[model samples]
Target: MSCATLFPRLLGDVGGTNARFGWQAAPGQALQNIRVLACADHAGIDLAIEHYLHSEGLDRPRAACLGIACPVTGDSVRMTNHHWAFSVQALQQQLGLQALRVINDFTALALSLPDLPADSKIPVGGPLRGAEQAPVALIGPGTGLGVSGLLPSQGQWLPMAGEGGHVTLAARTALEFETLQVLQHRFGHVSAERVLSGQGLEDLHAALRCVRGDTAPQQPLDAAGITRLALQQGESSCLQTLDMFAVFLGRVAGDLALTLGARGGLFIGGGIVPRLLGWFEHSGFRREFEDKGRYGVYLAEVPVWVIHTEHSPALWGAARALDQLH
Candidate 1:
């Protein structure tokens, strides 16, 4: 079925690993359909859409908004890690969508911050701002790292759309510098995403293994698998991995907070953080976030939170983006 023939416009959050789809049956209403279609499963966007629709018993949607992990430039969107590429206008015409919107996944997540339900988030450190002037920062890691900020303006929040995650991942300690050196050998131009994400955690484990004189596993381990091992209560190596991931995330989060002046506070989101909530709060994340030189006190005052919403945020962000059309 073509998108023109479907009712209840579809909204999607297409990331490096999964493509989440849903429908806005009415204004401000989010009807979700979690489709675990790997990008590697389909040949292209159209085929993926068809598979999702057939599996969900839906026809083509009219107005659609797709939140992709890659930067949305011009009419073409080619994913960085996934082998998927498509022309927006051409796909809209092919699907018969009246209107189609494409936005970066992180940007969409940032847009959904203001409307996030209280139950969806858990405060990590300090209190959030009561005033509307403060800016909020969103940082997440999954297939890659994502960063964005939102500032209050014109009676609503305005989200910043930039590639802040790809910026240099700074190290303030000798051990961290060593980790950077190890990673630099594997991936030449290392970014924050290289060290602060799931893949980074695995890499950290591999390096730690090397440092401990144990051969690292040749087969790759998924993010959840590593996190589970760490959270199991008796595995020292996994615990070390989790601890390092948290501390480094704290350092990076602090960097993002300083860069954006996120007085409203910082948020931790992504596929991994929520699962390690306990470890994160008890780990060096909060302390490291406030470890800046003279500005330590200033950063200490800024609050940080972890998003616990299990419904997924990028989808809500896509819906929020769609609401902006009015």
Candidate 2:
């Protein structure tokens, strides 16, 4: 089957909090009928897709592709943050589609990297010296920390789908070490997600308060509350939390860049970082990203860009994957 035969394909990016749907009416055509629905409102993925199609008054697509938040290792898919679980084949059959592709959300994001428009991204640090053929790294903190990379091979971008976010975090300073120790004691394993994600923001704030011998509030602040207080209200503890979060994110991103030798560049995505753009520019993020002592010069040449595209790149990527299926 060719892309021509797969007209009116369904494309989706299903995150932990929301699910975005789009339609591709023809080959090489732009997506249409883009819609976002809260994940909580639907009992399962099928219902959400059904509701989207019904609400849009669109016909059932012959082919579909979804960039899902969970790993797509097998037929069974269980979201890490939500309660949705189903077999890919079963759902494909239920949707009455000729083909269905399910891929990691970060993989979809990575796949869309090459096609990202310049206006959609804002550079953070380093010179614009991206190698034409080198790998590109991607790291983002959203409902969870997502990590992936795009390796150029045979003139095609291959997306990695590793669980790099769950890797154990490293601390560089005494204060950072103390905070990690506190988290380790509570969570047993202190992955980067423990300090970089939304819930992680709350955890870091609460832990910093404990480490500083500050009075503990009866209840901890949520991620949004902390961000609001830090950005808008100028709360001391919230400010500290945001600073620490940016620094930690820098370290993790640098580590990934080194691991992948991402000389092409490193791109930051997800729902959180874009909101703190102004603060992130002045934070220790760039300093720590280039703080790799011996390799500081090497990293200094590698640029970092934060993706700020209004449209969903995951949807574009899923559409790309569906195109490849032909």
Candidate 3:
């Protein structure tokens, strides 16, 4: 269904890190007034929307859809990684929107997979052709790891709602085994998200430092800092850390691809990955991805892509959801 009817409506993709806002101008029209606002600066969703609307001198939109990082079970939603909480109905009333829709951020992203342009994605590995009919996997490492899929069935792509990121991650090989052992002592269960998320990058560095007998390490580095240090061209430690991250990411992506038989390709979203694309394309990620015992050949043919669009995907997905409802 075309989104023309939702024209001039407000769309938001809210996350723990940033809140992306946009307006759907018309069916097949480019989303406009795209803006990213720091969620930490606002006290709540209403205030955040108010700040954006007031700053732009815009009127309250007729219809609104929010792609929130937290689960939208009922009226209230409490973000898992942020301190924000509010009721959807209340927000609609406060904003005077005729209809308001809210969905999980990852689910929203899954919806927009079929709509992303070729220029917005970068291929990391695998066959690029004939992926249109295969199931697509979507995974991202941000405030938390998100995993979902778009399964094509009977001509329409259906979104799969599952917690694939929470699955157990087994460490193969000596070095990876050592990293696992180091992390096991700190956290009981070592899920993939534990080592592939923002804090996961730091956890990897710390684990490596500990394994290498590096004096317990000092200085707390965020994900970006760790990536910057790795991409500095000559930092051995940072390079090792990034290599570890890339390989692990590939392994995770490969596993997801195999689990879903996602020959349609695996799309990487979230705030990370895009900056480290150059390093990723040259890393051991591809080799590790196709390292699955005998099923390696099957995975070797599946494509992988990185969603690099700055557009508010969740907003678009939310709009899609609204259109589906109508």
Candidate 4:
């Protein structure tokens, strides 16, 4: 079916904290009326969509596609980092849509990568370009961690969605080792997400404080507050937390690149990394990414790009999903 005929498709990129929506009126038409809504503000996906359509004064769409932060096995869908859950078939029926496609959020993100504007992505290290036919890796830390990729398949890009973020974490350095021990004690089997996400940032800060024995009475801080302290006020503890964050992120990103042979590129997404670009480009991210002893030479060749944009490119990915670009 021609995607152009699927006019006025409803596109959504739903995350843990926020859900961004857009309208693709036709195949070549730019996404219209993009809006970001707090997930907490709505009761469910159905309500959220209804609100958006009503607010925009848009008629019911012929088709719809949503990329949510969860697994879409069978018809049932549930978000991992948030409380929203619904059956795909039920939503389609409720909205009276001819088709409703639901997919993993990061998968949609991977789909958007090939069409990303050059200005939207800033390369961090290695060659400006990578192996043309090789796979690409993506890892991002936000309300939670999201990991995915795209591989060349039959002259097409196949996007992958898996829980790579939950893999067991590896650590080096005295502080790193001690912090890992603290995290393991608090939550058995420390996953990479334990130390790489927004909540992970807060938990990591607490763990570092516990490990370093700096029990000084101070105001509690979330990821944003911690970032402010480190970036603006030059707080020592927060600075160390971010440094360790870069080290672990680099290690995990390197591991993903090796696992997938993703020489095409390793792109960093999510809400956290882009915000830390000032400290990130200068931090140990690139160094640790290539810190592998035997694979150092190979990893050094992989490029890394940080995505920076206000609009969710995943919204486009959702539209692509509706188009069956798989």
Candidate 5:
């Protein structure tokens, strides 16, 4: 069966905070009527889809594929950061679709690596060595941290989905070590996600205050407020927090690259990094990325790109996966 036979397939990238939907009219055709719906606005996945279709004046699709922000080990899926939960088979039946494929969002992102347009990404540091055949690492921080990788096997790209963000965060500098100590005292385990996410930014600000022995506000600013103060107003605490966040992100990215031997490249996605591109480009991200003592030269040879595309790669990956089914 050709993808043309599956005209008007539904492609969705369902994240913890928002759900993006698009209509793939045919194979190789551009996605149409793409819209993002807040997950909180809907009661369940079924309602969100229904509202999207109705708003777009689209007909019921024959088949659908959703790249969801959770492990799709079976038919049932419970989002890690959201309240939406449903069974795949039951939802398919409810929507009267012939086929429904659900996959991990990070895995979908890994699958889209080959298709990522050059203009859609901004190179962070290092030369583009063109190690296309080697493995590629994917890590992003949003409502939570997501980690995955793409391995080239035979003539196909295989996506690896794992909880790499939950690994113990390594600290090199005195400030980083102090911050880690503070985090460990408060949260015990102190996973990388604890200091690299939206809430993580807020937590980092509070930790910095504790380290400096400064008085903290009764209620510190949220992630957005902190970002605004740092980028627009030049608040010292917010700026320091963002700087540490970038450095920590780079350290974690380097570890992941070394662990996976991701010489092909490292790609950064998610909602946060792209917003602070200016500061991130000038921060210690590249330095930390190549801070591996003996392996510094090797990491320097590897390229790092931050995805800046308006359309979600996960949505594109879902469409590609649906085409593969045919």
Candidate 6:
């Protein structure tokens, strides 16, 4: 079947915590029946898709596309932060789909960058413009950190996907180094995601207590709860945790920009940063991002935009991928 003519296509963006799905009927039609499903509510991807389709009262789709929060190297896909594992070919057969395409969730997000409207993106800080032709970098923190980039070629954008979030973390201060030591004891290899994700916020809060010799066994807090404590009660430890989080994010994003020379722009996506809102715009994230000494000036020219939307824009990205598929 020709890709463009495929109707009732299923578009999805599967994250560690949530799976967002949309239905597109015919070409150039706005996605309908957009829904967000908790990953834990369903047993696996197939069940989740079935539940979505059932609830929407939609028929079987001819083609389906997904942006999953894991490596889609071959037919076998094992989620990095969840237990759901399946073969892509098997899934296509089970759904009786004529075609099914899957790619890294962040890669799909990258594909949607150029098409993103100006208002949908909130500029955090930096010069107002970026080099139009340079690579555009993207990194975001959610259940795990996601990293990807878009390389401009022949007036077209090509998305690059990799597990850049698993890269070794770098520490900038004596306190940060000490914190890493504490984290090392708790988790053997502290990757960037260890200190930059949702769980990372909670773990960092506890690790900070250990570093400060706070022997008082306080109740554990999740990311939202921790942020509540910081925002509502001005808890000192919680405050510091968020502070360090922004700084670490900046440094990591800076490293990405430097590596890709992403002067076109650097986009921040995912569930965490946008919630930070005002605090994030004023946080050390930007400072640490440009703290690369001699290279600070270069980074200063790289524009940074934070993606915010009530629904998953990745669904549109999946739709675009389907259109591109031959």
Using TM-score, give the best candidate's number. Answer: 6
How does each model score on TM-score? 0.92, 0.97, 0.92, 0.97, 0.95, 0.98
What stretches of model 5 exceed 4 Å from their correct place? 1-4, 216-218
User: In model 3, which residue pairs have backbone atoms overlapping below 3 Å?
Assistant: none
- Stretches of candidate 2 off by over 4 Å are 216-218
Question: What's each prediction's clash count?
Answer: 4, 0, 0, 0, 0, 0
**Candidate 4 lDDT by residue in tens digits, 32-52:** 999999999999989999999
Candidate lDDT scores, in order, read 0.79, 0.91, 0.83, 0.91, 0.89, 0.92
Q: Show pairs that collide, candidate 6.
A: none
Residue 47 in model 6: shift from native, Å? 0.4
Candidate 3 residue 235 Cα shift, in angstroms, is 1.2
Better of 3 and 5 by TM-score: 5
Best-to-worst ranking by TM-score:
6, 4, 2, 5, 3, 1
Worst 10 residues of 6 by lDDT: 1-10
| Candidate 4 off by > 4 Å | 1-4
RMSD of 5: 1.6
- lDDT winner, 1 or 4: 4
lDDT of 3 by residue, 107-168 (tens): 88999988888999899878775366889899998877888888888998787766676778
Q: Across residues 23-77, which tens digit of lDDT does each residue of candidate 1 receive?
A: 6665645575666677878898889888888888886677888888888878998
Task: Give the clashing pairs for model 1.
Answer: 3-60, 3-95, 4-96, 6-60
Q: In terms of lDDT, which candidate is strongest?
A: 6
User: What is the alpha-carbon lDDT of model 5 when measured against the actual structure?
Assistant: 0.89
